[model samples]
Target chain A: MTAESERRTEIMDAVERLLARGGVNAVTMRAVAAEADVSLRLVQYYGSTKDQLLGATLDRLADKSVERWQARTRRQRECASPRDIVESFFDEALPTDRESRGFHRVGVSLEGLAITDPDVAGRAYQKHLKELADHLTGLLQSDDRSAPAARLLAWEVMGLAHGLGTLLMTGQLSEPEARTLITNYLERLGPQLCL
Target chain B: MTAESERRTEIMDAVERLLARGGVNAVTMRAVAAEADVSLRLVQYYGSTKDQLLGATLDRLADKSVERWQARTRRQRECASPRDIVESFFDEALPTDRESRGFHRVGVSLEGLAITDPDVAGRAYQKHLKELADHLTGLLQSDDRSAPAARLLAWEVMGLAHGLGTLLMTGQLSEPEARTLITNYLERLGPQLCL
Candidate 1:
């Protein structure tokens, strides 16, 4: 990568860390500089304003999350059934571990920003959802399921994952309990998928 | 209600409006005074600190959402099956109309607060989930289903509702699309509930 692009990536990385540690309230130009271990002038040079910096950071997060899912899908391409695909996705999406919990924390923060300020972070978040929906819809489409059915199922899974993840993160549900819920959900859905 | 409690409610109402319009960033002591047309001293008297104010607002929101769900459940008490209860929940939870959309916007912002600053708002949000779970679990426990099954299903439905609500609010899934997705999900889940 070019030196300029590398510097930009470092700055975005620092922004993500700040966002993860605390929500948007914790992010400031000075904080970014401190987190990135760079000068304030350098941070300013990389990201001109807070909104611009946040917007770019969200765009990068969207890209990274989608790419991660795509890579996971590729690895699981040889799974035996649609049910396997869905189960694998739940396994990955649930915030059981520390890293995933941090990711979900960032997501909830972004979700807040997205809903209240649709013009700023909303566009990036929506694009992220669309890309994920497109990817999951394609995965769910096979010999028996039509594209529309796949799309709905894709959304259903996405919604469940997101909600269940939130519940787990908030300490309302234990990890084992969440797994049990998913197991029952899949059992109920298995026959529908003719698995 | 007493005069003092009435004033407090009005101030909180203003906070909700600010939060709905601009997330957490828009809510300030001065802004609350302006929005509620109350004196700044009155706002301070009602809510001493920003965190205290936000915590009280979230607690109120949790109570309101749970009470709303309970009222809806009461109206649907005679529904023949668990599937009906789940369907009724989706109908109520989705942001299909303006009031629900505003409620949802408030919810997303609070969810961000809940996850990122758990000490500040997590307790109330968790209480909200627990109450909703208890209510839904009661609905699902009938002649055919056991308490364990009912509890799991309650959470699954809750999770799906929260996630799909986010998707809908964020404009990733339109209201009609969300309805269709729930319809398909119910169809798949029907026999599981033996409806």
Candidate 2:
């Protein structure tokens, strides 16, 4: 990568850390500059405005997220059933790890952005969701589940996983409780997909 | 309410409007003061801090939401069937209206807050979820469905509603598409809930 692009990546990483630590509220230009150990002017020079910074950061974050999912599934050579694929999708989407929890926070924060603002960042959120749905639908496609069914199920599972993640983070459901809930959901959905 | 309490309500209402329009970032002290049309000092006097304002607003929002649901049900006594209740819940929860869209924005913003901030506002979010689940469970409790089964179904339905609302707001799902999707979900879930 070019030096400028590398610096940009470094800055975006700082913004993500700030976001993970305290949501969008933590993401001041001052905070990003401090966290990235760059000049305050440098942060502004590259980002120009908060919205621009946020929009670019969101696009990058979405790409990283999709790549992360791809990396996890690409190496696996098993011919998994559609049901199993859906189960795996839940496993990957949930906040079972610290890194994943940060991702979920980024997501909910982006969700807030999408709903409340009609800016570039909002469109990035739509991009993220569409790409995510497309990826999951691809994985779920097979001889058993038709493409439309796969798409619907993908959206359903994504919604379930996102909502469940919020519940888990909020302490509404314990970690074990979330696991049990998702397990039951997969079991219930198993028959429908397998047929 | 006492004069002191009335002032508190005013502050919270102001917070809600700002939040509805701009998420967490918009709920700054200066912004809240401007939105409430009160002095910054008075805003602080009522809420004491940002978290305090956010917490009180969330509590109030949850109360208003539950009251609205109860009023809807009380007026339509004949619509007590599980199908009607579920349908009504989806309609109410979806961000279809201007006000409801704001409510959804507050919810999505708080979701991010609930993750990292253990403040009173975060606690209120947990309270809101518990109370929502309790209210939903109450709606589902009947001979037609066991309590445990009802709660799980309620959770799933709530999750789906939330996910779909985000999709709708982001333009990922159109109104007709949402109606069709909800119809399909209810059709599959209906037999499980009804005798």
Candidate 3:
């Protein structure tokens, strides 16, 4: 990659860290410069405006997240059962690791922003969610459910995962607690998806 | 209220208005002063720190929301079955009105804040959630399900409601669409709760 491209990635990484630690409030140009060990002028030269920086960071997150999910899906060749697909869905959604938790925190931040500010950050959040839903629908479209039905189911699971993640992060629910919750939830779907 | 007290309320009200419209970043003391048509000194006198002001506002929101839900439950009483309770739960969660939407947004903002800030804001969110769960458990804690089971069920419904609210705000789910989704969901629940 070019030097400029590498610097941009570095800046976005700093932004992600700030976002995870303190939401949007933490992502100042100076802070990014400091985090990246770069000069203020360079940060300005890269992003130019706060909105531009936010948009680029959001786009980067979208690209990276989607790519990660796609890469995971590609490693599996057996499209045999919807049961397996949905299990993987839960597995992917859970914040079982450091990277996943950071991603989830970023998601929670954008979601909070989207509620009140529907412009720079809110638009980005919708884009992320839409892409995720599309990816999930792709996974379950050929199952017993139709595309629309599959999409709705995917969204339902997404909603539960988001809520459960908040509960887990807040200590309201432990990891085991969330796992049980999801297990019982999926059990309601039964083995029909396996057919 | 005296003039000074009225001004304080005005300042806090402005903060809430800005918060509802723009999340935490919008609630600067200067912005609150401008929004309230009060002096900066007066705003600062009423709210020396942003965290304190945010805490007060969050506390008020928690009280108001719990009270609102209480009112909803009272109004919906005399309903024949748990089915009605499930339906009302979904309806109450819907961000269908401006007031309800504002409340929901504030709740989401606080929830996100709880992840990292975890000061008064996080405490308020947890307390609010607990009270709501207690209320739900009060409604669902009889007959067959044990107390723990009822509480778990309440969390499930709460998680689903929160997730669905995000979906609705993002324009992914229309009113009718949400209704259909809930209908299918409740049908899946069947008479399990009553037993």
- Top candidate by TM-score: 1
Model 3 pairs in collision: none
Q: Model 3: residues >4 Å from true position, as ranges?
A: A74-80, A191-195, B1-11, B39-46
Model 3: reference contacts kept, as a fraction: 0.52
Best by DockQ: 1
DockQ of each: 0.84, 0.61, 0.61
The positional error of residue A150 in candidate 2, measured at the CA in angstroms, is 3.6
Q: What is the lDDT of residue B68 in candidate 1?
A: 79
Q: Which of candidates 1 and 3 is the stronger one according to TM-score?
A: 1
DockQ (0 to 1) for model 3? 0.61
| Chain A vs native chain A, TM-score per candidate | 0.92, 0.92, 0.91
How would you encode candidate 3's per-residue C-alpha lDDT over A56-130 as one tens digit per residue?
788888788778766766766466366666666667776778777777777777787777777777788898888
What would the DockQ be for model 2?
0.61
TM-scores of the candidates in the order shown: 0.94, 0.88, 0.90
lDDT per residue for candidate 2 within B4-83, as digits (tens), equals 88877788888999888888878899998887788999998887889988998999999999889877877776857888
Q: Write the per-residue lDDT of candidate 1 for residues B1-195, one digit (tens) a residue.
A: 999999999999999888778877788999999999999999999988776787799788767876776687778778646777788888888888876777788777777778887756556667777888998888788777888888888999999999999998887888888988888888878777673
Residue runs of model 2 more than 4 Å from their true location after superposition: A1-5, A41-46, A75-77, A141-149, B1-9, B38-42, B76-79, B142-147
Q: What's each prediction's clash count?
A: 0, 0, 0
